[model samples]
Target chain A: MPGGPVNDFLDQVETCVPALRRYARALTRNADLADDLVQDCLERAIARRGLFRPTGSVRAWLFTILLNIYRNSRRAAGRRGETVNLDSVAEPASPAPQPGHIALAELARAIDALPIEQKEVVLLIALEGLPYAEAATILSIPLGTLMSRLGRARSALRLATGVTAEPHLRTVK
Target chain B: MSAVTHDDLMAYADGQLDPGRVGAVEAHLAANPDAASEIALMRRQSDALHALFDPVAAEPVPARLRARRIAAAQRQRRGRSWSWAVAALVLLSLGVGGGWFARPLFEAPAASAVLIADAINAHTVFVAENRHAVEVGRDDSAHLASWLSNRLDTTLGLPDLSAQGFALVGGRLLPGEPQLGGRAAQLMYEDAAGARITIYVTAALPDRQPAAQLASLDGAEAFYWANARITCTVVGTLPAERMQAVSQAVYGQLTDGDVSAPRYRS
Candidate 1:
């Protein structure tokens, strides 16, 4: 059977699933809910495949859909007064923090405390490693606004993790 | 070298600065210890974020999040719904044979014609089956009525057709024309002789003008009527008098409270 265009569209979407999951995990800080969000995003993308423009990248389009769904769910959860499960935040086993290393657990908590908008910017650029232009498009914000948010997010994170002051290193002559 | 701004330092730290500007930013960082320290801290912050969430990307993706699987499931769902109309069309063609001849007693309005065709198609497709005739069986008539009423966004009580020798066989919600409120409810009734009839209903048309038409389509009799509240089509292959009796009964019960309903005439 000739799967053709549909198969190609699905293949492209499949490639972006990992990053979508990663971004969602960082945003929600809960693995199960993060996967649920990804699943919802993928289903919507597949359903509205016709609406997707050929010019935009699939990954960026998927991120836009994922963010819209995330915002909607957050709004609904807010109305229900839902409590987030902090324990669900995946804390990978890491070596003890060195003098300059930000403690992983502390950083995760700091991320949880960041405003939703800033957290999104941080994860898209820092965690997913998307280019500033792509991340800005995904967030539907101008490049200048994205930079400012990233700056504010970095400052908040630095203060939250007590990494605002850097270690003084000897300068090489 | 131009003065190194905060945005420049941030871009350099995030590894996003233009390639040509990188050299200038490095020179500024070398001359300014404080700026250098700030850039290091920003890089570390990015590192720390990756450390926290990168594992989520590296981990094996769950099957549910697989795009192809989701697409396949959605296609199946869409196909199932579309199958109703396709199956109806096929059966309608078989029942009508070559006689695409449809004689209308009155000028069949375009909206009423489509509704009548859909009603007869639904009736032709489901009436032949011994089981799986209705989605919500007659056993749950109360729930069926309320559910169909809620779906159609109007107060839809199950019309009493028992007096006409046909018992309620229950109803199922069907997707309807987008212009006609985009939803339809099909209520099926069966007589002692195993003859089946279906009443298709939808919210009122945009115009909400009252209309009534009787049409012989695809060898089935269809009585269609619309009021301010709703538009209904009753379809069956029963004899002329029996079909008229059943349609009149359904029309009376369904449009009982709607003052705008025009009187149903044979």
Candidate 2:
């Protein structure tokens, strides 16, 4: 096989790796497991390079594969009775922040509590900065469904964070 | 001009609204404190999500996640599989050329095992030979299909796997074990990535019993199935799911109108 397409494909995959790792980490909340997920996703994508069309964005395609692999792993884990303990993982180390800052740990826990559907929708749009159209496409849902999931996820986060007292806290710069 | 909906407010918060509509949404946000507060809370949630996860993208990526390295390793593995196939072919030629001297070394492996080995060996040997991958090319697919069918004495059709991203590279006949059948037809297919797979088919074994087997030898994977009329094995180094998809497509086409045969799978 010629090296040109393979090289190009690898380069495309390389560009998305960091973002993939970030999304995987956000979803799994374990560094090692998240990396493992990314490795598996990359392997699958490379092996199936023939099926990937050049017209579509490689980033979206990689994200789609990553999400599918994540879902399958979660399903397998569910069957095997594996449970993740968010409390057990070491907390992210950040020094005390200014007043009105959202407690990172509280927000993390709130995100973890979201339903998987809403969680995927929220993170794809919010954390990954994907357009609503692309996020909906990646999730294989209608645009309306994507909107509802985002709405519900944000509401759940707001409730769980107990930030109802003052909703207009502009992010602490 | 029109009453702004909740979707419009959320779209504004998500930065997805059209530029022309941005002014209308902003005017509405200023006029309605509740709408403004709702959009603010949504934006805050997005900002919090970013704060929680954006650092991950900046952290040094692990070595295992490097795509170039992964692709290189995969290429190395494919090369290794071909080497093993070549070695197997050398051993098989020894068994054939030396006859009685090497009989013990080649004593009838399981029929499926022999078939899978032959399929993979043929796949490795011919796939690398760009100029002479097959005796007949896909351009003469009609003649190739019929000639192979006549040679094997079983009805065979050219399996179209274009849907699965593989196009038939055509086929050639090869010698086979007398115990099962004296001849086999090796049909090759190539995908856009130039990855090649082969379907090795022959007349059924004497007992004509249905059998299915999946084997991963070296790096290549093989899916073999036998029916009353014919035996088919698909061999490739593709990942399991992709291999399954190609094998499934091949099975569907070749087994058309034959219900007795159990579906072949990976």
Candidate 3:
């Protein structure tokens, strides 16, 4: 019953579940599947707690496991002939676009359409708000590669949302 | 000041630029409206992306995804699998132990039943005794061999099992079933690891039938065979393969010229 360290590990994992779920939802655009992915990631992290290195933060490690599971499942799904479940695709409920904000629904689709590699980098940094270094480490990409992917993703998103012209700002009374 | 690069502009938009370079990038943005607007679009895209997904995090987590629950489920699964492993081992040993004890009842001829039982019993009783494992120690092997040969009324040469890592540990006489022979000689051998094996020898049964049989009795393997000259059972609690090796060697040497004796297998 050496439960102290294991309990601490589970507590740390519990704190990261929300972020994992969010990242997974953004990546898959399917709420149920995203939570399933998060569950799988958490189970794997718990099972292989011994293999976890102490040098990296638990958040980064969890992210790494989540992304790996996500990619592997995608690959398996691809091999099985991708099943696009229309019911499972979560359509973002967005409000009417404000002056400074781009269309959130359009942005969601744009993010989905980006190459998976670029999509991962964009979501890790922009959605998760992880530090550049940590996102780079989690993605196992060089900082330069991360930045370039971010640049490509932003440009792609901007193009997809048709945000080419600056909107005129009306001064409020 | 180093002129801002595209990467620097992107990093600045992302608010990831070094603090020292932030002032320089701000000054560059003030003088450069197009660069400023491009940075603005990147920020808007980031904002839109977050707006699209951040609510997912705010939703209450489902019970199935709880970390403690998952850990508990995994522990339960591991415990069940371990119990299955232990249960399998118990069943396996039961199967082997049952087979080891039930062999004589099913396979052995009535004559071999008594002899193999006697051989294994003698082996178990003597091998455990460190000081008195052999009545006549190997130092008196010549006298012991001849004395047992006279008592059993057969010229019994002590089978050399050194190739299989067992050496002579001398022998003694034991009273045996009168139907087979009134007396038997038990020649003991010991390996470097102190594992002992005994060869139980008796003059041929009344029938003088040439026969060969193997049985696992009481956790010991007894390889029994008879030729015209005598009946010999090599007994040991060694592993099956090692016991087979020692048994094969003894069978080959003891039944050398007895052409009627069948060769041992396993």
Please give the CA lDDT of all the candidate structures: 0.77, 0.77, 0.76
Query: Distance (Å) between predicted and true CA of B187, model 3?
Result: 75
- Please list the residue runs of candidate 1 whose C-alpha ends up more than 4 Å from where it truly belongs after superposition: A1-3, A90-96, A168-173, B81-266
Angstrom error of the Cα, residue B152, model 3: value is 85
TM-score of each: 0.56, 0.55, 0.55
Give the per-residue lDDT digits (tens) of candidate 1, residues A2-107: 1356666776898898889888988887888999999889989999999998798999999999999999999999998967778886565878666677888888
Worst ten in a row by lDDT for model 3 chain B: B96-105
Lowest summed lDDT window (length 10), candidate 1 chain A: A164-173
| Recovered native contacts, candidate 1 | 0.72
Q: Which pairs of residues collide in candidate 3? A: none
Q: What is the lDDT of residue B199 in candidate 1?
A: 92
Kindly provide the TM-score obtained by chain B of candidate 2 when compared with the true chain B: 0.57
**Per-residue lDDT of A1-173 in model 3, one digit per residue for the tens?**
21366656776887899899999988888887898899899889988999988788999999999999999999999987965444554555767666656876667778778999999999998888899999999999999999999889888887777676366642222
Ranking by TM-score: 1, 2, 3
Docking class of 1: acceptable
Q: Which candidate number has the best TM-score?
A: 1
Chain B alone, TM-score of each model? Answer: 0.57, 0.57, 0.57
Tens-place lDDT digits, model 2, residues B61-141: 765576654654565356444534443443343232333223223333256556666676566568889989999999999
